[model samples]
Target: MIPEESRFESDPEELVELPPTLPDGWEIATPDAGDRFTVARLTHLLRAHESAGRGWAGAGVDDVLLEVSEASLRTRENVVVRDPEGEIQAWGSVHDRAGGRMLFVHVVARDLDERLGRACSDVLVEWAVGQARAVGAARGLETQQIDTGAFADDERQHRWLAAQGFTMVRTWWQMSRPVAPEESELVPDPAEWDGRDVTFRLVRRTGDGMPEEQDLREVHEVLESAFTDHFNSHEETFEEFLHRLRLEPGHRWHHWWLAELTDGPEPQPVGALIGEVSPSSNGPDSSYVSYIGVLESARGRGVAKGLLHTIIADAAARGRDSVGLEVDADSPTGASELYLGLGWETRYVTQSWHRDVPVVEAD
Candidate 1:
């Protein structure tokens, strides 16, 4: 039998110095895939954490399990604080998303004693910092960036993150638009929408049900160039881009789309949209606009609206409840106006927090 103490993680001795010491009967241990009780506790903790922050629970068991699953253990790790009886009271997860970007998740049980809750928060944040250092050093980076988020109304989360050296970096507007069954007829099948010489349609697929390499490459190129001027824009290689997107539970091949300028002698791919299926346990599933971009040259045209219409129609055809997306609340383009004109409404708002810390040099 694997000892619970060492079951989930093997901390890097060089990066992690002086282990955490918790007060009360709380104990620190990483989560293990084989432990059913720990997994249940983690799911509960995630749900409770979101509910406390936004007035309703969003993440379910499957979503929590996906992040900590055996397959995902390669680039992600999770730690939790357990009571004397082994029930989890706090949780944290770290993902080495890129060379210097480490995605972090921190959650403390909302119902615990106030004093103990703060203690748990401290330990979790400290662990996250150590993990950042370990990840950065391994990547040969001089500094590592820890990126985390919280609901707009989550003051407790804000306070904890601020106390630990994290600063609010950005605010995002989460918006959703209802999809009606009748809307399916608006775009019709083969959804090749066109306006002002711009064309929007799904990415081509080969007979083997795999996407054509050229089309996929075009999609990536279009998005990369389109977002060059956007906030916090970071260059991602094609390999890294596909690897991360494919890992998402919502990723779907048929949902990929492209916008093209056909007035030229040859079709020029100038925009792309990657849609995913957002599963719902208690209601009809929704379609999420994971990444949507239109080249600056094609902005004045209706490329973006056409891409959105295709997704909305596709969602309607699939019997989805709504279409959802997140946008930069303070975007220079004032893109929120366009979304609002198209019937999208803010459902909730979220904030991104970031901490840049020095990495310990690897031996």
Candidate 2:
């Protein structure tokens, strides 16, 4: 068995004289069949290092594991680190979507200090840069929401990320509320639609992977059309959307809803909401709204509020204590207001750190 001591060292000041390289006995294996071995080893060590990892409070190693697992399934060439004894200890992956490539990294478990962690992260960043270069991307991007409380639990992670040249480029807020019997008061009256011809519907898939292709297509179209003007809105292709969702451990076909224009002979969906349930290491249970969108024409019809309610109800039905979602504090659409009006209070502020790795200049 690989010794845990070597992987959980707390030396934040490990000298950085030599540039970071792959750990001993670790090899950068090709993509196609890397998941089985890498995921098993990484998951085991990460759970073992639960409280020992730097970012324990916010964005726990478990959270990062979920993020990386989903990312690996969406992105290609997922690079993983293995010990001399063949146990995986760290990893990161990249997904090319929305006209750009996104870099995702997470430590399985490490015996290193702040400076050393930064050095180790650099290896992954460099690899991402190279991958972006190979893909002809104009710039490379990475995202981390500071409000996730990751910084609060592990100041070293924030310091190290900033030291590595990432800059704050966006911000969001996490909000939530208890499911009360009178929660409907927070929403516009469905009865108010008596004069209007529009109707709303809660949509779900048949099974885990058996989503209605047409509904998925409609939701994607609605999302693309709706969020085009929103901050950091990127047009994710259907393939990319499917790939990302498939990566999610708790992704369910029933975890979506679509709103339609009722006047049409065939209901024309114009809005959508996507969410997922995640296992919590700290508490009983929780769910999160990953994405929510409504077409420009569908915005004022109470569709957004209705969809939120549907998602909350779904969470409650699943025995989850609370539902969580992030929204831009200054959204042009005033989304945070909608969330707040519905009794969801700000739990934490999330700042987005970004870096532009411009394409290499041609010789």
Candidate 3:
């Protein structure tokens, strides 16, 4: 509950009213840098509760805090709801991605009565869509799209998104596999590369572990080309791609790897795999595959398999507990089959929803 005197005072245009389902004392305010810890705690609690029936893992406090910090810097709008005692009950934000052509909204709320939950989500969704429209107008674009996701088992979230005019666009599999202590044998030996003149190596870094510019550029090039035909693929600038990945917690230069083929006139960069360490809710640290791609020309040459083996072996060497990744369930490349063969199993599924916003022209 927000105090009477400390209740947020904002321009009438910016002030979003609490839904009638909520208590009269509830207040809405924009969070600042100082609210990182509180926001993270609230996010973790809400996600944990929501994930119970979905079988997906909730994010750790460190990762949530990093996300909050980055959102405060990069997003177009962010807001939070507080109870009468001033405890954060819900948080939401809208990120304008791909230069305002796409808006991604994230809303998390603590467990409450169904009516209150729906009311809280409604306010956030309305505010997020309004922000998206403003961003589209500023960019002079005719229209923009709003995107959000919900776990397959979370019917309440699905209903809220449907009521907001978002349609389910795609489904994804969240998969994970345990890292064995002696998995080095699982990695293919160098001699096994008989017919395919391919090699896998970690991205070169300086003494301080900063990636070399050339290798980093090659990584971006490979991913851009490989994902050209992928589902919902978009053209992201090299700077945006790198900056987004670097903002994640436990992102390290050493976690990036590349696969090259010497059979070409010159060494050809065929595949790239980037990983980050995540604190698991169960106990030990886990390795997450953030991005993995192989060029179309290199698909049949086992480049993708090599990159996966390299990451798995590295995680085993570092004593990480497991490796996790998400894959497009409808991918034409049959990526899920590859993970299945390597012992990865589906933990849960999530659906992506999209809504298009009409742009407002200036008078």
Candidate 4:
């Protein structure tokens, strides 16, 4: 149990409270019933409060909002907390990704009082678990940032999760590279690699409306070929990827790039780089490389480096301050080494905790 004493005497707003029962005026709702307003409120709460601000510190408000929106659209179960005035104070949602169900809890706002914090979390978890059981979900998951430095509260948070029966399973590193202000260094001069015949272009449908079937087919082939040997080499369908990306608030179509094999039978895309920028927190100031992959046939021909350079130059040209991405610490592709060689630095690390859960029996 969290200590009864308030952690912050200077600010009464900082106290966290856990309750034996729900507070008098709070109500809960499902996403289908106009829950986005609640999500927006909790998002603001998390953004404004320092303690709940770390995981998405570098992300823009618009980006996070889009994430929540996407999740709301996909998940069958979502728990929202609203004050008596019908204003959302906190929320947590579940993502039914791949074969497992992930409980994505975004602690949007917290009171200075510890009791209030505990109360909010207690309700959120209880609701999430109940929803999982109702949906025949076997497992629950959450992502919490682990601090590499002494000043962070990751230890306490981890201990709390363990107390709730979760354990650490895998880890990831937050890496970043500074974008130099001078365009002379990062951009590739056409003269330097002129004869290589290698070129990168953003993929798009020929028409202006909904994505054409051909465009999606290409996205599927490119992503599948790119991550054939990647660390978490699980197959996520094109529809899933499309839905997920479109759900992101800051998702921009042009940020996705494809390297076409100029000599190939189909002018096929052999490598791809996907990126996004936040308009809320990163303040429309920085771009983040969300994912990148190079097809097996395209691996050794400077495709990866060329794609990275292209993305970096694009972000810089767009006036981004820094570029960020995550690399598996144990990736066999030596991706971390490549990023390091290009000047990206490690900020810290985070672990992925997972446990095999027994499937719920069908009635």
Off by over 4 Å in 4: 1-27, 31-40, 48-64, 67-72, 81-90, 101-103, 106-109, 112-119, 133-153, 184-197, 209-213, 228-233, 263-266, 280-284, 361-363
- lDDT tens readout by residue for model 4, 1-363: 111321112111222232455568766654333355554565566555434424444333553455454343444334556667776666665554433334345353555255555566566555544444433333232322111111133554454445555556556777888776574346464112221556676666566755456655676688777776765455566765676677776688777776777775566567777788745342546677887878886778887888788777877777777788888888878888999999899876766544333334346
Model 3 RMSD in Å is: 5.7
Which candidate has the top score in TM-score?
1
Model 1 misplacement above 4 A:
1-9, 12-21, 361-363
Give me the displacement of residue 200 in model 1, in angstroms.
1.3
Candidate 1 residue-wise lDDT, 119-198, digit = tens: 78887777888888776777678898889999999998998899889999999999999999998976756357776798
Location of the lowest summed lDDT over 10 successive residues in candidate 1: 1-10
Could you tell me the TM-score of candidate 3?
Answer: 0.87
Q: In angstroms, give how far residue 338 of model 2 lies from its true place.
A: 1.2
Off by over 4 Å in 3: 1-23, 52-57, 70-72, 100-105, 108-110, 188-195, 361-363
lDDT against true structure, model 1: 0.82
lDDT of 2: 0.58
CA shift at 190, candidate 4, in angstroms?
Answer: 11
lDDT of 3 by residue, 275-359 (tens): 9987755688888999999999888888888888888888887788799999999999989999999999998888989988777
The global Cα lDDT (0 to 1) of model 3 is: 0.73
Which has the higher lDDT value, candidate number 2 or candidate number 4? 2
